[model samples]
Target: MTGTDTDSGRPLPRRLLAHVGVAALVYLGVCAVLLVWALVVTARETTDASMAGVIPFLATAPASLAFLMLPANSVVFFTAIAVGAAVNAAIISWCTRALRRGGHPDR
Candidate 1:
């Protein structure tokens, strides 16, 4: 019944941002789990055979430092994952605000 509620009856961009934030949180959770697994593997005296298989791919990827240092590897991996997730959340927030200001209704 309000300007925000079109015939489809949606609350618009703020609502969408809430959804995006929830999804980003879920993704961050998964990343945390994976980082824990990586740390466990790295802590082992022997290198992870499975991880060794991916060495070529990782070697070609940016920030090769993760493949070299001990604690630094885990730190860099976890930091990058956290930072990337935060950046994704921020971009979603920015887009939502932009759409709302531009008068775009909910999809």
Candidate 2:
């Protein structure tokens, strides 16, 4: 379940790939829920109040530190989803790798 990291000689989990998948599920799952909520809110009669754009806007709010090359937008939400997932996966991987051996010292 672990592999050696080339850069720091740390034991990175092989499940890092699985972590990305899990992160994707979590990220997109939230986006889907927000999409549904947005639709529902749009459908309701709220006397000039609505959450159609605002609710789903969160999908693109957090820029991925790991993958920032692609512009996050509706036309590219597919890529953004993967980018978001990879960022979360990378963070988890780094934590697990660093924490595995008394934690790496910041340099």
Give all candidates' CA lDDT scores. 0.52, 0.53
lDDT of 1 by residue, 26-94 (tens): 545665566566656656746474473233323223433333444545455555555555665566556
Regions of model 2 farther than 4 Å from truth:
1-19, 47-49, 63-107
Residue pairs with backbone atoms closer than 3 Å in model 1 (clashes): none
Candidate 2, residues 1-107, lDDT tens digits: the string is: 14443434433543434444445445556766776676577678675335474554556446433334557555565455446544554565556555654644752
Off by over 4 Å in 1: 1-20, 49-75, 92-107
Clashes of 1: 0
* Model 1 weakest lDDT span, ten residues long: 52-61
Best by TM-score: 1
**TM-score against native, each model:** 0.42, 0.39
